[model samples]
Target: MTETARPAYKRVLLKISGEALMGDQGYGLHPPTVQRIAKEIKIVQAMGVEICMVIGGGNIFRGLAGSAQGMERTTADYMGMLATVMNALAMQSALEGVGVFTRVISAIRMDEVAEPYIRRRAVRHLEKGRVCIFAAGTGNPYFTTDTAATLRASEMSCQAIFMGKNGVDGVYDKDPKTNPDAKRYDAVSFDEVLRKNLRVMDASAIALARDNKLPIIVFSLDEPGGFRGILSGQGTYTTVSG
Candidate 1:
């Protein structure tokens, strides 16, 4: 393989917001976009890398948003968890459509639709070259999907967590969409992300990754071939480490 086609990781966990699946729509899954992401995952898997995925449910429901509108926090959070399961199923269909084997594992017990989250089974699925999509936000309230992604990545022993974003390509000092002068970092330390309050991931997730010494690569999901390109060491992205 050429240098540009060589992937840098043996295994990784991809974390994306449900908003990423919505495309230009205000909310809900956009089938074309979902298929596009699945194809990206397929490219990486073709390179022989184990894959785990965690997709946020912000497009369909957000517990914090529900709470802000006067719903009970825990109930809203559980509702949000269910939303993630929906997203997971959508992604599973897309991945399967592309001929990439996938498993939708839920943290909540919903055996009819998805398999319950079991670390060993999930790891075994990855070992067998199937993509594992973790859903249901750690099966608890008060914790964001970011935390769930970090927790799952740690448990799966992923080499890195790829934070697939929409719009902007990498972590910036300011909101790039709002500020034309926003500067994107080539690399940033986890401490700097916390001290600067940069929006790489949640504080808890960042802390967990830092504690475990796992690197995070922040990149745009909208860029065609972007995820695979990054793994091949040929993309514009910010690496968070040390």
Candidate 2:
């Protein structure tokens, strides 16, 4: 890798599952894991790239899981949104620890904790070189964080959305963990992803990204420098677009 490599995109959104923060633990955040990921983002930001982030709340509470357990769907979803906020704060603390300025912007208003999601304000923050962590899943109960990430990336005019997976390196035809023969594609189409139910993201997210003609780069978050490597155009990952 180059000592100081240039990033491919001027601006991008990083979407990771809440479980990525859990590290080796069964649930919740692992401080070391969070810090490690923060350092990766710091490396990219140092290359003069603007970043937006959306972290899912599966580590704390999954709205769908809660609903499946007989809880009210909307209420459970709101609870899940709050979980994302907690994860965002944890990430914000880690990023700041590495000397990267960050702002936790929430779709739902929570001025005491995070700034309310105002499009102009969030874009300004990115223009000023701040990593904006978008929390609270679109402020809507039915939407998943995947859809929220796509929406935010589109609104922010991000060049692409990077879906950082924990163990899997890229989008596979089947769950690699379950099926060893699962094939990985260097690049796949949005229509195919939706057709096969590839599970890279939700249907809504995939459709929205397709409609906007935005690219989604899926890579391994577990690799030490995977995120930065991608920004530098030195990584192996799958691209889902058009």
Candidate 3:
């Protein structure tokens, strides 16, 4: 799409899982994968879209998984939050390497590592064409990064949240990986998503987005130019809204 073709939304929050940065590796950040996604963000940003990002830390450590392994719940969660900060730093480096101004803002107070998340400051970054990467998952235990994305999206007054999945293209009636005949919904209501218990996002995240009337666009990060194409209204994605 050309620069003359205006995007569907002005400002958007992108929520990508840390696993998306892992590439074929079982764990840790893959430089090439992070660079690829960072380039994608750069493309969209070039179109004058103010961007906010919240990356999950599942590739490093999952709070629930750590807790399941007998670790203390709060400690596991704090570790998970730290993992997100690492991912955010990696992403910041990649984005900067690609000439995109980016900031890693953490919900937790870690001045040595990342700038503490301040709502107005974050908004100012976006207004200045700097991509704001929110880290640390709300700085609290038991809250998923999904919820953080929703909360930040709302606070930033983003038009929608773009959720980039690794392999899955969009939300489905069943597990497409396991079911041969799963159907993908082009558009779905937030209430329906919660009522059916679909995995588009966790229940808390979905409910938060629902209550605030924020739309989520789920698309495939595996697709080349998929994020940009979706914003340009030329890609297949699932829209979850009221």
Per-model TM-score, in order, reads 0.98, 0.98, 0.99
Clashing pairs in 3: none
TM-score of 1: 0.98
Report residue 186 deviation for candidate 3 (angstroms). 0.4
Candidate ranking under TM-score, highest first, comes to 3, 2, 1
- Per-model RMSD to reference: 1.2, 0.8, 0.7
Off by over 4 Å in 3: none
For each candidate, the alpha-carbon lDDT, in order, equals 0.94, 0.95, 0.95
Looking at model 3, residue 237 earns an lDDT score of 92
lDDT of 2 by residue, 1-242 (tens): 78666679999999999999999998999999999999999988888899999999999999999999999999999999999999999999999999999999999998999999999999999999999999999999999999999999999999999999989999999999999999999999999998989988999999999999999999999998998888877777999998
Please give, for residues 105-156, the per-residue lDDT of candidate 1 as tens digits.
9999999999998899999999999999999989999999999999999999
Considering summed lDDT, which 10 consecutive residues are worst modelled in model 2? Answer: 1-10
Sorted on lDDT, best first, the list reads 3, 2, 1
Question: Scored by Cα lDDT, where does model 2 land?
Answer: 0.95
Each model's total of backbone clashes:
0, 0, 0
Which residue runs of candidate 2 sit more than 4 Å off their true CA positions? none
